[model samples]
Target: MNIVFPTLRNGLFGAILALSPMLAAQAKTPADQLIVGMSMVNLFSIDPANAPGLDASGINANLYDTLVKRDNGNPERHVPQLAESWTVSEDGKQITFKLRSDVKFHSGNPLTAEDVAWSLYRVMKLNFGLATTWKAYGYNLDNIQASIRATDAHTLVIDLPQPTDPLLVIDSLAISPSAVVVDRKQALQHEKNGDLGAAWLVTNEAGSGPFTLSKWSANDSLVMTRFDGYWAGPAKMKRVLVRHMTESQSLRLMLERGDLDLAYGMAAPDIKAIERSDALQVQALQRGTMYYVAMSMKQPEFAKQQVREAVRNLIDYQGIDQQVMPHYGTLNQQPMQLGLAARLPDPGYTMDVAKAKALLAEAGYPNGFNTTIRILSEPPFIDIAARMQATLAEGGIKATIVTGTGNQVYGAMRARNFEMIVARGAERYPHPYFSLRTFVYNPDNSDAAGLPNFQGWRASFFNQQLNELIDRAGVERDADQRLKLYHQAQTLYDKQVGPIMMISQMTDTAVSAADVKGFTGDDAEATRYLGVYKQR
Candidate 1:
């Protein structure tokens, strides 16, 4: 898929140009106005199932709803929207969710269990890692489609094909309104039109959630107003207007000029710029996300296992995080060890020029291996890739950065087109399963069961073990046993998997203090939208 982003440097991007005091003057607090510019480079579809990159997920947070929502304000807790409460069966195969009594579509249709079953089943059968959480949910379900049965109007009964743990999967997939689904056959018809039932829900609001999508002017802004019949009563803010601003300089300018109350998905370098100004304030979620460099398993250097190891031995995350992105970064962690498996491996490879040189020689690349890495056109991300290029150069890897919008890079990455890409990642939860399922494991099946697995890792030792361990994690719920299984998976992944990378230099985000409230802070992918409110 080809991708292109609009130039934020246009007159429209000039922050103070339209916000000058001489222009239309109005009395409003910074919190009263929320306008953001996303550098077109990172912009992706607002639809969850089709979102092209991490930024699209950010946009979907405002526009969509998920089942069994994660509390964005308090990441650890959950508050039901479509389903009020749920029960797990003894065998862990069946999950019965008790639906909320007073929920309706943003378009005013009463939500029901049939809608819930259809929504979950449709996502699973479509079979793209369609949604991150949905992918894991797909894996957990030996077959959820057959198991989903409506017990009553306000209840959803999901029988898992296997006894998989719900901690990671359920936390990630947001529940859509059952009233909207109506039936399974209709959703498939729309999926052909670039509209999952979720995307169609976009142009017109129809979920039993707080905000009703009032406007979605693509390539410009998206707007939402509070739902009056919302179970939570009313949101703190009156209306939420999400404008598109892709440039960091433009986003910072709007904030300084008082044209915006909050801005998120900021570039790493701009964090300091905003923090230094008294006119603006910032609050971070300590993202459960991470960014890394990846290679198509087929690349020559990566084709040789030892060459890949030499590359991993070469990344200086500590030095890069400090010098490049300047955000809070952990040198020893890959994006996988985070999310659900908080206690997973921290692969710490020190920056020893001599050792790196030694590894290169062992790999038969005494001179150096040349490579080109692709990435979205964001300054902070670009900085990280540049530093990586320099670091790899010192250890005998000549790397260059090729930048584009995420949609452009991600497609090529998936097709194994680029030698490497600076992959900025953060999962919706703290789970190893997410990483293993999506990035770590390469699914050879046409169904694409796990994810794009662009790294192309196919080590029998690693692949065989990971497949077994994921199953082991389901049956063995003893926290200790599950961890052992996870560790074995990690050891094989880190040492054998091809993409040797870092999590230090990546984008950091913040909300304008005045924009909105009631967000659950830690839930990955910012779930639990039933709790979100448009501050009044």
Candidate 2:
């Protein structure tokens, strides 16, 4: 809930606003500590096996240990965390990891290969979070535990259900929910019925990371205290207080007043202004995520390819990016990002209202039609959706904007109970396979399959050709052949006119006090705080 303060023009209100900083100063964390003003309503869940929200995943990353870890700058480069070394079988069907014997959980339990096997097996059994990612690699209940087993106390072996690419499975395990290792003994102590403590772990954390959950109050704040027993040594700060601030204005005010050491989710304009401040540093981190609008093929109006193509052309890509999204996003249409190999150049489509109207007429809707645009009730997204609504109106389409929380908005999309939607998607890595698998290919669009891998099911899109291409690319051993197949998939996606993919926004801007050191601008590594410290 947002608390709207009275206008500053009011005498009493002006006085109160002026005094707020002094009041907040008393509650501020010490200079040596880190206090962040974040843009989150509340944590969805802290249990790594179940928490799918980005904020919760980030917090879990700090609270848990993974076998392999990525550096602050690069997601492709994997380094050892719990496992010091590993060997892959020549047949590419099995991998054995050597667990570091010196590591211990927060509870002082020695880390063992049994914990590794149990943690991964638990994910498949629970079947949530990254469960689908494993399913994509052919690990099912019939073969999951059979394939992943501990050979000895410190040797963890993973036998692939089918030989494809071991790197893909490893990459999936490097991400949250899949990578997270829990204290199985501790969790089982609190187990209820047959849940494996999945119920109790929802609020409590059981891991061996730099910090533990000191406290978390819904819609208000979350506090994490350092764990001195951390394998990587102690965290620099004693505590990290994350205060929930929905409005960007509140974040800017708290950051400017020194009540917050860092502020995330600031508006582009506010970020631009903060960049000029001598005491503050503003940074942008590019992520493999894209914000887009889609029209469901379930609707008769969008069933025509011409209508979908017209909707794509109707987006004022340059206008919106330059005007409202400057300093925040880059105009991109395809699933492949700019830095990756085999990425195709933009098709050079610009907004032309007349062309949109012509296309609509050709599709038997001379005056366009009515639809609802679903979006989350947050900054920039709501603002962007409003801009899209206005632009569509000019092109003879009537669009109603509906805003709600992440659950409400995305839930509707996933259930296929929507006409149009505005949402953001992130690839597991900067790989064409990830995006293609996520947005385009749907092997089983039936309700029984649960549409786990393919979000395209929501839009009622199914193409056999794309499915074949994705399958071929998945198992293709030859590098050049794989790249060619991926390119072919991208071209096929464009020709199908599936969704209106817009700009790939710079994830978030971080505005922090200059004294704050070792702040990684990468949002992908948001929870990495081992090196962060305050300069004297």
Per residue, candidate 2 scores C-alpha lDDT tens digits across 1-536 of 11111211113233225333544756444865788877554366777776666677668877888898665434456788888987778988888899888877888888788888888777778876356677777888788777888888888889888756777766666764556888889888898887878898888988888888888876557888898999889999988888766667777777777777888777887787788898789877676667778778878999898788788878888877777676556777777666778778877768888888999999999989988888766666777788888888888888888777666677777677888887775553566777788778777766566654356776788899998998889888898999999999988988888864655544666789888998785445335676789886
TM-score of each candidate structure, all chains considered together:
0.82, 0.91
RMSD of each: 4.8, 3.9
**Candidate 1 residues 326-418, lDDT tens each?**
553444355464435434656676667777788778878889877887776665666667777778888878876676656667767655466
- Which segments of candidate 2 are over 4 A away from where they belong? 1-23, 26-28, 71-76, 523-525
Q: What is the number of backbone collisions in each predicted candidate, taken in the order shown?
A: 41, 0
Model 2 gets an lDDT of: 0.75
Q: What's model 1's TM-score?
A: 0.82
